[model samples]
Target: MTAASTGDLLTTPDDLFWQEHSESITESDEELLRIVGSADLPALLAALAAATADTSFLSGDLRPPLTPVDTVGHPHGGMTPLQQERGRKVAFAALKRLRDEGITRARMLSEAETDTILEYLGNGHTEWAGMLRHELDLAPDKNGAPDWRFEDVAAGRDFTALIVGSGVAGLAAAHRFRQAGVPFAIIEATDRLGGTWQKNRYPGVRLDTPTFGYTYSFAQRTDWPQQFAEGHEIREYLETVAERSGVASLIEYGSALISAEWDGDAGAWSVTTETAAGTRQVRQFNAVITATGQLDIPNIPDFPGQASFTGTAVHSQEWDERTDWQGKRVAVIGTGASAYQIVPAICAGVERMVVFQRSAPWMLPAPAYHKPMTEVFSWLSRKVPHYAQWYRLWVTVLGIPGRFHTVRAEKDWPGAPLSVSPRNQQVRDELTRILGEQFSGHPELLKHAVPDYPPGAKRMLRDNGVWAKALTSKNVTLETSPIREITPTGIVTADGTHHEVDVIVYATGFRPSEYLEGIEIKGKEGIEIHDAWDGDARAYNGVTVPGFPNFFMVYGPNVGGVVAGSLHFMLERAGEYALKAIREVLERGIKAVDVRPEALDRFVEWVDTENRQMAWGQPYVRTWYQNSRGRVSQIWPFTNVEYWEATESLDPEDYDFLA
Candidate 1:
């Protein structure tokens, strides 16, 4: 499908909205076409109000509606039918005037007008107004113009910098560096880009979050083929972002970083690299950014006798598309997110499938998880300027801060092991109801599927009834027995039951707590970063370290899988902060800037303290969020908005400047 041009509304357009999975127009497309095609104010207001209703329970719209309408991919304020009618009239008149006058930019609206519109869209609340401004790049400049572009503030000074990995975070870093006129090189271990997206090639691989929230705020897309996009589409989007941001040329593909040694005297890092051709080279840079994200490394467990019995063993991260699973017996180890997605895609083809579950993950309801984006809605976004941005803001509001209340541990709440607070209990009940409904026919399977731990204790899986359907298949078996060992033929359970399979697929997640492992990073006084971490990795604000001077980690420890917001938003802010720190060094003539040890200690303490108050810190919960030492190090304890504010500006008091 091609992108729709500025003129064409009915004809199929290209670029962002094209879905490779389906070409047929949907009912949603027809509905959206009808809404945008006509110029009738009353009808438009009705359609607009109906389209933006609070179906997702997002936007904090608790008010009773006059009538419920399908509000897929739209934002609505919480209001009674009378209030909605009044609101529709006001919003319609304002929006119509803007459209007629060609006022597309945020600068066109006065501060009061902007606030009014933001408050209206935000469900009569001022909470998300600041976030909307920052996220949409509508923050005003000194001259009252909405300008989000960072100026080259390095005072004409130039320095060499090296970025490891060309993943989402690294690409973002490269973009920031290019914008700031910094000469930099991005070294990606693999031949291609998109890091995890490029590697995980299993069928039906897609994001849990909405596509609107997943995209880079700076580079928004109008055409997302689905509410939740597949892996290839996201990768393609990133590649497009790289090209458009002028960072495509700055990337050094196939060059993997081997080591980075800081020379205190020279005030530079001697970075070593190895190519696919066995060529090793050392390059010097003023600073090194380790954007080699947490999820890059696959955590492969050594199953006993696994080497002997393996017909074909593969980690989900290292999925080989060439492997034929047609009519083959498959043993899926670990029922995590990967397994949840992988099972439904391959269950129908496999002769017999066995899913070994250590713990049943809590599968949350996501109705539109499998639904595709309609062409008409895509066309509406493209035809109307600022429409896509507004939609994205709606997504951001829904995801970023909407669920923050659920994760926080309410000390006085009645629910304990099953849930933390009343709100969390409500969520658990909803999720349990959905799971139960999915497996209502199979009572035994449903029993094994329900998790014992409290909801939000681990990573939540998005369910569209596919996982339960796959498990209930006659050819599939969900094994809850503990595996004692792997035999030559198959897996040996503690009960001495043997389940034979042709292929062993490990759906085990990544070693997220082990931040920047394998790479030797030696700082001042030969202080190794790993040694400083001492099996418990900690970084100030999850980016900077005390011992590691002139080094910044993007998508680093405690920040990757944040529950509050999209990873893209976190990484973008992180990349921006890293660039700011880099600029500070060049502008101030500082050789190195190290986060003060005290500051680092305080940050770590704060993270620990905050973690104890969250679900991830529940003593009974065993998740990837915790390290071997049982410390929660992978997730950010605070909301995304808090992290954004903290990283928005730099504080010199927190760091020690060295000449």
Candidate 2:
């Protein structure tokens, strides 16, 4: 029918259905115009059916096959499903005839149609924009540039940089040096390119952050198969980033940085590395950047006779994929984030799973935790301009602001050990309510599932009922008793009770406090990094150290965020500062630049003060975030914006420069 005559059809639901279902329909369709003006019955029905189909698809239901329905031979009436399926030949002919005969010319414009069209175009434009960005190797600016400039340096004949750990951070540092035309090479303890991403290949191991936010600010990936990329994908992405950025050539994968000493006479750093070939090589460099992340070493708790466990035991980071757990009674130690994800994943195959919980994680609801993108939504994201961008912005807001509410302390809260304040208690109450709703019939289960600690005291876990379901399952048992020892057959509790298991998975987290333990870093005056802090790692802005002149650290101690912010945000800021400092060293021909003692002290004091105000600093909370001195050593006690602003400009007054 002609667009004008389609007014009657547009008023009916059928017209609405046709307009909504037509993927090729442009923004200028007149029947769409009429439907836009008034509610169309057909479109409503079509929309409902489409939504139903999407739900079914998401739930893994089989889709019905398209079958031809009979139709009357009256212009638009005779358009049977079979005819419409004829590769658009019949539909185009019918439309042409209708327009030619002037049977339909009614045009009704509506705000809804305009919105829908704009959404479509917006998504299309975004896809194009992403493609262009990927091709150009451009990452979207997360924060504005820093307000620092490199000071002029005395001309020097030689300039060099020593990078420790050939991981993402290390490689990124090397890449930055390359771009700045600085000579540098990476030294990694492992004979591999991917650091944590390379080492951790357990099943279902993946990034919790979105792929876009997780990647470097200079590299953008448009074709992430999943919104949250798996470990393999992340590793591969890092590898690609290295290769495409030409930094891979500069990496010496098997060479491990053993120790680095600053030579005051030479005005350079003397670095020691152990090669895979069993040879030790010492090189000198003008600067060093420690890119070793915090989550490398697995922190297996010491239970008496843990070595005596007869069953196969492995840490989550060192998961033994070769060993099968099917029908075996498995014991999982710790209920942290990795444990939370791995427990539910493997509980189905295990005959009986015993989870030993030292502490419970404060669980947050993740509605789309296991849900996949609907085909319609995916299509709209790809085909419509700016549609996906706006949707992403909405998601970012939820994560940035709303998520931070859980981290703040609530004073005078009734629930001791669980919530610090009333507002914190409300969050706990909400989460407990969600758990209650999930386990509607099992009140007893709620007691064991809910955590007593404040929400942000520990890492908040994302839940999808998988954990709750696994817990309530008949094959699962939760243990809260203090473990006395690991017997030949299984675990022995403090009360002389034994729980037998065929396999043990240590979900105990990492040794974040032990920053670069094995690697000996000797700074100026024969000072080692280990001895400098005496196991208490601290730095000015978590980048520059006092005695370790011209040295920088990315993702260093106290730079991590417990709140739901991006780590990349911290990495970029640190990198920016490092780059500016390096430029200053080059420009002024400075032999060394160490953060002033006062600056370092002031920064540490500020970090401690801010951390005390947060839940991580609470005495009752026992997390890897704290060091041996019971200090919050792993987390940054500031907002993402604050870090960005603070690192935006490198103050020359903060450092002592020597020429």
For all candidates in order, the CA lDDT equals 0.72, 0.64
What's each prediction's TM-score? 0.86, 0.76
Q: What tens-digit string does per-residue lDDT give for candidate 2 at 1-659?
A: 43333422232210101122222234334553333233211112212212221111111111112121111012211224443234133223333333344332222223333223222222222222221221111112123232332222334357777777767777667666665666677777787787888888666677655554566545544345676677888888888877877877777878877888788888888888887888998888888888988899999988888888888999999997797899999999998878887888889899999999887777766555555544444443332222233333323222232245556555545676777776666777788788888877877767777877777788877676788888888999888888889998899888888999999999898998898878887787788788889768998888988888888998888888766545765776677678778877776666878889899899999989878777778777877789998999999876555675567667988988888
Best by lDDT: 1
lDDT of 1: 0.72
The positional error of residue 137 in candidate 1, measured at the CA in angstroms, is: 4.1
RMSD of each: 6.6, 13.2
Which regions in candidate 1 have their CA more than 4 angstroms from the true location? 1-77, 87-112, 123-130, 137-158, 412-414
- CA shift at 115, candidate 2, in angstroms? 24
Let me know the TM-score candidate 1 reaches against the reference structure: 0.86
